[model samples]
Target: MMEKKLALVGNPNIGKTSLFNQLTGLNQKVANFSGVTIERKSGTFSAGNQMYDLVDLPGTYSLIPKSKDEEIVARQILEESQRPDAVLVVCDASNPERNLLLFSQVADLKIPVLVALNMVDVAEERGILLDTQSLEKWLGCPVVAINARTGKGLNELKAAIEKAKIPDLQIFNPQAVFSDNSTAEIHDFAHWLSLQSGQEYQHTESETAKTDIKSLQQARETVYRYKKIKEGMAAHHIVQSRERGNEFSFDRWALHPVWGYLLMLGILIVVFEAIFKFSALPMDWIELAFGHGIALLEQALPDGILKRLLLEGILAGIQGIVIFIPQIAVLFFLIGLMEESGYMSRVMVLTDMLMKKMGLSGKAVIPLVSGVACAVPAIMSTRSMAGSRERLIAIFVTPLMSCSARLPVFTLLIGMLVPARAAFGPLSLQGLSLFGLYLTGLLGAIATAMVLNRLMPEKGRSTFVIELPPYQYPLWKNIWISVYQKSMSFVLEAGKVILAISILLWFLAGFGPGEQMETAYNQSLETSLASGMQRAEAEQIALSRRLESSYAGLAGKWVEPVLKPLGFDWKIGVALLTSFAAREVFVGTMSVLYASGSEGETEMLKTRMLQARNPDSGSPVFTGPVVLSLLVFYIFAMQCMSTLAVSYRETQSWKWPLLQLFYMSGLAYALSAMVFQLSS
Candidate 1:
């Protein structure tokens, strides 16, 4: 049997994607539309004996194309290439009047349509009722009320889809809608449609015949639909109740001028604290497991290059990948909760006024908040913004928002510099320090947005209109899925890069040219023998000397002079150079370098880092000042290659990403130098 295709369409924040997720579950995958970065989410589902392919189109308020994402939706609706067999229009039950405008347009296209009236539960809670049977009869189509979050009425909605059919009567006349418009483009489009549909067109010659004909027609249609819908509701006796009187009362405090900001700040502090305190146990377990695995490998394999590579290169890289899973998982879980409960939309509303001063639309808040998870998707989210200039600014500043990838680096450094005890009346000093780092990044992002707003040329004025979705209980299933998918993506995507670099670094640190390594080993052996050193001690000294003369050592020495002012040694210089590929690779690089030099120590990477010393001075390398300096550097540096590539792709130009790289790196260097100098 042939598979049927269906297109899912709705206005923004109407629960279209949630319904799609319910239908497709784990069978869905995301792809890009042709010649655009806009995402195309397609999936397959089986109903009875028949299979269906569903495409979740980007949400839009109307058929008008104003942005890249909206353009994709409009093109898919108008173009005939690979058109769906049917279209499912999702609408909010509480405000069906506002949402029916798109449905009216879709019905005019003369396609088979099925209406899924979603959020019925929310509508009922808000003391609103919809007469579904009367509405379905009035529209001459099936209307099934559904709650996408809890899978309520989903089966009935699917059954309606199975029986949906195209109606013979068209609700709105396309020719009449555009015949009297002054815009040449609209007139031309109307004439073409009339010719195709075999209808007559009535053209107007007056240019001032109310040039806003489109808006006027939309207003007329909206009034007409609402009037008909209200009559149907009255005939069916759908009444409003007073059970949920306080449903919208909470908005008074949430949207307040003063209390809103304080509430947001307190919420952020709690999120950061949860991330640090909850992930500690799991992170420790992962560290312990990897350390034991390395020890087991050492005991099983014979002493050779292969054994060294397995223990130091492969295991160390894996350790870097696994140790951060807990942090990444927790970050996404909290973000998902905020989104599912509708708190994120409130945040957008709260920041809208302040964001306008920075020349960004309130809609840019979604991408900026999402950047805390990962910058790639966050940058993509900006495509929904209505203006090009705002989108570009949002993309450019998002990377500074302290993503989950930075969590590992920040936690490592904070663990070294700050103690685990409470300070300032029962607050964890370490947790507060972490919170400060996150705040610093957020402030930097806002400051950068302001600067870019002034620098970038303006294309058009952007508006910030958004629907504040009502708060609801978050679904545990969705939260778990989000956390799992995001955490796995980080490990798989970054793990590949880390593993390859770790092997290369191991090779460089293990081998050297000519007899330099042999000469150093011989000199160290002679000195150890003259000092009456034991055989084990002498072997360790010789090994250290050999590592110092290896290729990695020479490369480190080459950059040592440049990094000396920042309190970094040759070994740190090497790690810094390798970390350009990714920020997390710094931990893996240090692990491999230190493990390769240590003969048979079973210490974890953190312990080894604490005990490390400068070969010449024999003083601790990771002093408080040095750790803080490194932390400052990572906080500001554009060290991730993947983020740079994504920025270039989104902007379609090298200038922005390259400028970002240099500006961030320069800032990192200057700040790190200052911190090192002041602290020392």
Candidate 2:
């Protein structure tokens, strides 16, 4: 049997997503909508003898869209090719007037829709008691009150869906939808809408033809719909007490001008510390497991290119990325907790003023905060911003924020530069460094936006509108699912890039043009023995010398002149070149290079980096200035190709992405050179 298709529709923050998660569990997959970057979430579940396919559409306030994301919701509902078999309108019981506005609009479309009145418990706690039977009678449809967080009424919702029929309701006539003087476009749209509702479209002429007739009609229509809705809901949804809840008390401080910013900063510090402290043990275990696996493979397999490829190329590179999964998962878990608990919305509200000062729309806060996970989705999220210039600015500056892909490289470098025992009071130096780097990225983004604001012509700005959800305990299952999905996404995406680059790097480092590698090995061995070095030490020296003469080394050497002033050697230069594919690939590339250069050594990448010596002066290669310079470089550089591609897609032009790449890379280089030169 064909599965019945249902779409979950509602305004933002109505527990619609929570209800979807409860229904789908871990069966859902996230993809892009047909021709847009907006995320599409869909899944399937069995309902007794029947199966159902559910899609969660983007949240919007009304059918008339103000942005691309909202446009998708409107199109999906009204277009014949994409309309769902039924729509489950998730409404907030506490805010019936606002939510019912959307519900009434959906009802007028004459499509089958069932009301999933969500957050009933919270509503009752606020002294708002909703009469489901009365609501059902008014709408001529079934209404099921559900608490999505606790799985209450889930079975009933599924049952209601299984038996749902076309709602015998049309709140308004399509023929009378438009004003007599409406434009041709408005008439055509209404005509199209009427066709879907099986209603006739009528045309009328008037002496005055307003160019903005659609907006005028929509405003009038909204008032009309709400008036009818209020009359229907007057007695059914009762508020027994007008008392303020704890939400008000909390918001007093959480949205305060002073305390709110401090509280938010303190929470961020704690989150960063937790990411470092909590992930240490798991990261160590992962490293140890990979180390042992590599060691076993080294001992069991004969010395050959295949063994080297398996151990040095594949295992080493993968370990570089896999060991960071715990940190990535922790980051996502803490972020998910903030979002699920409603604090994220508060953060957006708090930062709106500052964002405006930076010449960014208030909506840009979502993409900026989300950039911490990955810039691709963050760039894609700029579609929600109303103004074209604001959207472009958001897309351009978002990549400056340090994403999870940079986390591995940052952690690895920080561990080498700042000792684990170093601390400032209760905070570890490494954690502080991590937070400082993130702060730097944010500041860089702001600074760039300020400059862009001055350079670009003024486009009209949209007012910042946001709904603050009441504070609640996070749902652990949802947090866990989000963490798993995000961590796996990082692993799968980074793993592929690392594996391909590792193999290519290994092959290039293991071979050289003509007899250059053989001559370098022979000459290095002879000189080392002549200096009275032990045979084992001499052999290691020979291998290192051979690596320096290989094809990858030649390329690294070619770039060394340009990078020399930044305190980077040829090997570091090579890693820099490969990591353009992804920021995290810096770690994997270094891992592959070090493993190929160091024979008969089983030390971890960190140990090898710490012990590394400059070939010319024999001093530590990763000196204080060099490490600082490198960190500064990665912090500012547009190093990921995927981010560039996403930026192009979001802006629909190569000029923006290309300019972003050159600007970021140039800034990274100039800043790194100054840091190294001044520090040295």
Candidate 3:
């Protein structure tokens, strides 16, 4: 049977996406809409014998085009070819009036739609009672009260969808409210909408002169709809109870200028500490597992390049990334909690004044905050920003926000340099160090934005308007799904890059040009013997020399001089080169490079890094100063190729991305040099 197409529509931040997730489950995929970079999410599901294809349309406040997202929604609903078999209009049960505007507009287009009254539980908590039957009667369609969080009322919603049909009554008649001169323009617009929806225009032309749609006529239409809606709502008793509740009382403290910032800081500290402390045991287990696996493979497999590739190359690289999954999951889980609780919006409000001063749109806060997860998506979120100048600045500075990819890198280096222990009460010392690195990124972004704001031409004023969602306990199911998706996304995306680089690096590090590797090995044996070193130690030295003379080593040496100023050796130089593809790959690159030389050593990557010695000076390679320098560099550097590509795509110009690359890299080098030199 052919699948019926359904478009899920709603205002931003409602339960639309949650409902979509419940309906489609794991059958969804995200892609770009035709000829546009805006993300399109669609999925398929089977209900009984019939299948359905559900597309989650971009959320908008109205049918009238105000933004790119709104324009797309408007076009999709109005255009006959693109209209779905039915549109599912998800509305907030608590504030039905605001959402009803959009729903009424969609109903006017004559499409079959069912109102999924989401968050009814939240509405009940706020003492707002919704009369579904009254609402259904008033709208002339089915109304399903659904709690998208817990899958409540889902079966009923699905049942409603199967029998969905066009509304029995029109919500408003524009000609009834519009004056004579504007009646013609309003009638023409109605005609246009009908023609676009593939319906015959039935309105009589009381005025022959047709003109353009004016703001005055649009205002009259909106005013009339709301007036009729208010009367009908009272008549039908759709909203049985109303109360302001304690939201304002909570917001007073949460949005306070002083206590709010302090609360946010405390929350962050607790989160980071939780990440380090909670994930430690799991991380240890992962490391131990990989170590045992490597040992077993060593004992079972015969000595050959295949064994070496599997053990030192593929396994080592993957082990580095996999060991950090617990920490990654914990990080995302905590972030989800903050977002789900609606506290994140308060944080945005707190930073609004400061963001505007830095020449960012007040709306730019979302993109900047989202940068903490990953910059590629964060940069894309800037499309919703009102001004071009604001969007450009946001894209340029977003990568400076330390992403989850940098989490592993920071955790590794911090684990090596700082002891994992509580300090100054319950706060973990290592967590503080991690927090400091993130703070550095935020400060860097702010400083860069101020500079860019001065240099760039101002095109338009940026307006900041955001509604604070009511506070509620995070739904554990939603949190789990979020954490799962984010964690897997990181693993799958980073694993591909790490795997390919690991194999290529193994080949380059295992074999050298000509007889250089052979000569180095022989000379290392001779030197070790003359120094009276043990046989095992001498063999280890020989392996190290062979690696130093290999192609990868030669490449590292070529860049060693430039990096030496930051207290980084040739091995670090190699890791730096690989990390340009991805910041998280730094850990995997270090794993492969260290594992190849330490043949037969199955210790964790942390132990390997901690025990590393400078080839020339014989001093520890990752000293406090050097590790600090490395952390500083990663904090500011534009190391992810994906982010740069996204920036290019978003800006539609190489000029911005290239400038971003050079500018951020240069900043990273300068800051790292200063950190190392000053600390030394």
Candidate 4:
């Protein structure tokens, strides 16, 4: 049988994606539409004996195109070639009036439509009720009350979709409202249709006409639809109670000026603490297991380049990526919970005034908050911002917000520099220090936004528009899915880059030009024997000396002088260079570099890094000052090539991303230098 196509359409924050997830489960994938950067998420599912292809279109309030994302939605719904066999319009039951506007517009398309009244539980809690039968009769289609979070009413919704039919309802007619002066494209299309039907064109307009006839007509249509909706509600006795609700009471504090800021800070502290406390056991187990695996591999294989490559190059790099999975998973889990509970929208409301001072709107807070997870999608989230300048500023500075990629770097450095003991009652000092680093990144982004606001040209005033969604219980299923997806994405994306760099670095560190490596090894062996070192220790010393004469060592030496003032040595310089491919690669690079010349030590990367010394003075390389400096650097550096590429794609120009790269690199260097100098 031919697979039927279904489009999932709704306004922003209407639980549309939740419903899509419920229907598609694990059968979905994300891709970019042809010739466009906009994301297209499609999935396949079986309802009864028939299979259906579901496309989750971008959320938009109206058919009018204001941005690229919205334009895609308009084209997908309105163009005949792209239109689906049927559209499932998901509406928030808690606030049906505003949601019905989009539904009315989709209904006017005269396509097969089914309404999914989502968040019925929240509506009930808020003392608001909807009469599904009455609403279905008024709209001339099926209406299913669904709880997307819990999968309640899903069977009904699926049944309705299987038996869906085009509604014989026309909520509004353009021909009745548009006259001779209308300039909308809809009016032009109506006229063309009339001509094809043997009638004369009834509308004409000069290009200079100042009237927004389409908007005016839409406003009128909205009012008419509300009137009909209200009458149906009255007939069905659907009404709201007079008492104030729990969600309202909660928002009163969550959105307050002083308390809201305090609560947000507390939430951040709790998140960091949770990341440290919850992930500690699992992280230790992973590190220990990998260490044993490397030891077992070393014993099982004969001494050769292939054995060394397998143990130091591939396994070590993968271990670096996988050891941090627990922390990444926990961070995403908390973020997903906050988002599902509807608290994040309130955060946007609370941060608007402060964000305005930075020349960003409240809406910019969404991307900024999401930047903490990963900047690629965070920058994509900025497409919903109203103005180009505000969106650009948000994009340029968002990289400064410490992402999950930086989490491994930060955690490793903090473990090295800061004590693990508790600072207060139950909060670990290391956790507090980690939170401080995250706060530093946020402050850096805000400062950069302020500076850019003054320098960049603006075409128009920035607007802050947002809707406060009703509070609902977070679904553990959704949270787990989100955590799994994000954690896997980080591991898979960073793994590929780390593996390639590790192999290349292994070759560079293991081989060098001419007999320089041989001479260094022999001299080191003689010096170690003269110092009366053991045979095993002497061999390790000789191996280390040989690595110092290799290609990667030469490259690090070239940049050593510039990095000296920032408390970084040649080995760190090498890691910095390799990590530009990805920030998390710093850990992998260190793992491979430190493990390359070792004899049979089975210690983890952290222990190896701690034992590393400056060959000239024999002092520890990762001292407190150097560790702090490196931390500051990673927090500010534009070290991820993926972020730069995404920024370029988002802006559609090399100019912005290039400037961003130079600016961030300079900032990182300057800050690291200052921190090193002050601490030392």
Candidate 5:
């Protein structure tokens, strides 16, 4: 059955998306149609026997088309063919006057509407008593009070909607209803608003124009008076209470430039520690489980090229990429949680001062923080940033943040080099090393931004402006859905790339130039037989030998000489090159490569990496320099394929991505070379 469509709309930062998520649950897809980059969030929910399509619109202050985004949003509202069945306006209960002004504007469209008085609990806590009934009567629409975080009043909101029938509203087009000459006095507001509306106004120099401006001033005053009447005085008192009542003032400490930065540092330290400590167990389990499954696939398939492709290449690549899904999901979830709560605003407020030095709008913090998950979405978040220079700068520098995709490489290398033993205090030396890796990556991003700011100076004066949203607990369902979607995309998209590469890699290392692979396979078969071992172990040994003699290994060996000075064996060299497309591939490549190289250990892959040796030196290969070099390379390199593609698309040119590739590769090379030279 075709579902009725409803849309949730609101000013930016008011919990509208959260409410949409709560209604739709996990049945949602975020995508863009046509030109705009705003997330076109559409989902289906079954309220009764009927299904409904709920679209969560981009949050904006008004339905006025300004930039590409504002234009898209405004056009959607005005289009007669695609008008929603009903529109639900989400408003901050504590900030009703501003919200009501917009609400009245939407109500003028003559569509059946619902006013969601969000943050009502926060409003009440500040001694603001919201008369929802009065609000409903004032707007002639259903007024629902909801705390999207706690799931409060959701059922009532839903029931209200179910009972919803379209009502006729008086269309009040402000432009049509009011026109006067005194536009000179409020010229700034008019110009700012006209830009949003995409309208051009003609001004003339005359006393009559002054009279006209004064008349328009009177029109605006009339609108204000009507707005107040539409919103009861009692409700005004409630909202005013909220603005003045909160005792938890941050002006003293957390807002201080010095103290704010310190607190931010401490918060980041905790975040880094939590990501490493919590995700380790799940990651290990994924690695182990996939390892066993791949082994089984080898045994079940025939001893030929197809089996090798299926077992080695596809499986290897998938396992290489999918293992990091948990970490990526965790990172996105945590960031989303921080954003849903009001704390994100405070960070932006504090950082705008420093961001100015970097030629970024304070709003650039959104993209930068989001860069932790992946650069593509992070770069897209710059839409909220007002100025072109700030957005461009954000796009340029966001790639340097170590994304979740790099976590696997860092973990793999850290485990390979730094012993898991505890260091001075309770901290594991490995954990501290991981923390250092994060710092290195962050420093690289900051340095890159600093340099870029100096070189490509902004043409216009760009200032940082960010809204401080009220604090609330993260809705778990909303967070889970967000985490799940991003994690799934990483698996489905990167998984395909890794799977193909892994299989090809497996084939190369699985089968060799000729007899060496066959001969090794035969000897393993004979040894397993001589020892009377099971068919499975015998098969494993054969597969291992075939890989040792395969093209991938030969490729690794041929390149080993070139990489030896870079503190990498041919195996490490091949892994490094392949890992350019994906850092997660490092772990997968090592697993497959080690499986090809090793003779005996059929146990855990992690143990194999720990015990791995350099063929020439006959000593453990993963020394501090080797690991440090590899980690440093990943820290600066733009390794994610998706990120490169995004950079190309955003800039509408390949120049940026190509430059990114050259500079990152050069930086990785020089830094790794240094680490190797100093340590060796």
Candidate 6:
């Protein structure tokens, strides 16, 4: 009845996680590595009569680790607490040498090992003949070829796992595992090792035998002498085989500097169009439910402060945020799909040269994609960038990606006011505006990275190394689970903050600081001109005066002068500023602000927005200039508190999050001001 633990270990992009997911299904869970914030994923399933626990470990090239992630994997191997009962060593059959380099290291570790030869289909397509039996004979392990994408050979792999036995461990082959200087050195050492007898390494229920220190040192020396020769042989084989007779389906053409960029842009446009078209229905449904709730709340209660707070403030805030869920979910789904399907690495591959110009590795692509959701996770995703400097640049620039949180604010402004017009022969002007906003985020991020390259001292070779995983159809279950999890997390975490802000804004705007509002209301009633008309005007004036005297209103007025050119008055300036905590807050704040002193029939939310006026100028607000300005602001602004919190955690510094805040704010202000000025 003992619980058996198994680990799926492999090089990055090997689809090890996909196999793990296929096996575990809905039984999976995520946790932080024992002491580190880096996450570890695990799951359980019943295979045969036993309950099996599967752990997906961090990937590494070899146990002799370099970066923090590699160190974590190596440490887990050494530590008793994380010891797995058996290890599934995953490899790509098409590129066996690189995978074998990792496999050879794992084989020496002396654990219960099973070799998963992934991408066998690709190997066949490329005309590479893999003799699994010969490989098994050479490595002294069970070799199971698999296509994780199609569930092919999964049963064989599982059966192998169920019946596996750990072999007597081999000593580390330093010549093969580490750096080498000459081929002569390798041959001499291989002869020397052939002359000496290897001890039979053993493991017990409790302990693995200590590796011989003397032999290990000798192996290291031999490897240092011969590794260069081995690497050259591997490269030569790859080239001669591919060039002469066998041509791989994958090509260098995919990474060509000019064509690759144009391809990436075209793909990006297609993705955006898909996102917009797909998310429409869900967005409409969300908007309708939210609108219904607000109406129901208003109808259920008598006119009072509590009713007003609930109807105008809290309900409005909820409506502002809920509409974004579908869009954000779809965006995350598309990103996750790209990553899983392996197109993401191609982007990283293609962009590596460009990244050098911006002082980063193409590996920064991870964070760049993750930034679509929130900048925090995006920044943390830079852990794979291989250097602190590159990672830092990725962190600093990632916030400029205009995360999904900005969708609500942009959607509200664009959809409500921006009329449909033609920007070109066929494209809608509104659609072009949307694309422009997204481009602003992208251009600003690249600009910031370029400027930082100039400001910061750069050293060390930031080589961009990545694997282009074999392409496959996007998995439905995995995609659905990812979309659901990402969208739900946003709703639950940011929703709580937004909901609180809405309630707080309601209280602040509904009631005044002192007895000033009461006195103001009484005076307006007493100074009547024409009885009925005077009473109505007095009530409207009192509401405005009360709001002006309120805490939120006062704060708005204080910042109004600085923000005026963005086509925002005191009220709008306040809403925009408060929305820094969340973009959705602007909608909620506007709803409540307009609801307070209305003279027209309040029906659709759009109608309410249409009637809002600038208090000082006494002119209609939320016009073309204001709507365009707002869209530009949201496009350029980093307005999500979740994104800031994430950036703080990922970069392990307030400096980064603060810099992101100021950078985004400055960009937003500059862009918004330009739009407003041009339109005016």
**What TM-score fits each model?**
0.83, 0.86, 0.83, 0.83, 0.78, 0.78
The weakest ten consecutive residues by lDDT in model 2 span 195-204
> Number of the top candidate by lDDT?
3
- Tell me each candidate's RMSD, in Å, in order: 5.6, 5.3, 6.2, 5.7, 6.4, 8.6
Most TM-score-accurate candidate = 2
| Colliding residue pairs in candidate 2 | none
**Candidate 2 C-alpha lDDT tens digits along 253-278:** 88888999999889876876676689
* Cα lDDT tens digits for candidate 3, 1-680: 89988999998778777898899987887766766666678999877788999998987777665455666787777667877999999999888888888888888878898889998988899899989898998888888999998899999888888777777647667567766564455453335344233111222344346433444455677787788778878998998999877755778788777888899768866875676688889987887888899999999999998999999888977875676578767877877787788877787787788998888855776677667767765676677665567788999999999987798789889988899899888789997898889999999999999999988865445556677878877777767877776666556655566666667777887899999999998998999989989877677668767877898788888999999889898989878877776687677567656653332233477887888887667998889999999999999999977677777777788999999999999999999999999999
Q: Model 5, range 1-680, lDDT digits (tens) per residue? A: 77888877888877887888888877898877456555588898876577888888778766545345555555665567667888878998877766776666566555677878897987787777677765666566788899877779988887787655433334343453345443334433223243345332223446354544433543464466355545554543433344455534654566776887898778766765566667878987887888788778778877987776776566656666766766676667777777766667777887787888888756778788777767755776676666656677788778888887787678767776777899989889987887788778778878877888888744545644456665566677867887777676656555565566555555555656657888878888898888998886577657655655677667777888877767888777767756756776666567656663331233356676657876667898777788777788888877766667666766677988788888777887888888889988
List the candidate numbers ranked by lDDT, top first: 3, 2, 4, 1, 6, 5
Q: Which stretches of candidate 5 lie over 4 Å from their true place?
A: 46-50, 66-69, 119-122, 145-243, 247-253, 256-259, 295-303, 366-388, 403-423, 427-433, 507-569, 587-628, 646-653, 674-680
Please, what are the lDDT tens digits per residue for candidate 6 over residues 1-680?
77788877898877777787788887877666775556677899776667789887887665555456765665665457877888888987777766776665565556778888987776776767666765665566788989876779988888788655554324444455444443335443223333333232222234336555545654574454335324633443532333122342444555557776788878776766666688889977876777677778778889887788777777767765676677777777777887877778888877777788898877887678667656644665576656677778888888788776666566667776667788789888767766677788888889989999888865534655566666666777777766666666566656666677767767766666788667766665666433555565556655655666677788888898988889788878768766766776776566545643321122344666778776568788878888878888887777767666766766677997888889888888998999999998
Q: Which ten residues in a row have the lowest lDDT in candidate 6?
A: 239-248
Worst 10 residues of 3 by lDDT: 195-204
Full-model lDDT, candidate 2: 0.78
Candidate 4 lowest-lDDT run of ten: 194-203
lDDT, model 1, position 645: 73
Poorly placed runs, candidate 1 (over 4 Å):
119-125, 168-171, 174-246, 294-315, 362-386, 403-422, 428-434, 514-544, 587-628, 676-680
Displacement of the residue 639 alpha carbon in candidate 1, Å? 2.2
lDDT of each: 0.75, 0.78, 0.79, 0.77, 0.69, 0.69
**Model 1 clash tally, residue pairs:** 0
Worst window of 10 by summed lDDT in candidate 5:
186-195
lDDT comparing candidate 3 with the true structure:
0.79
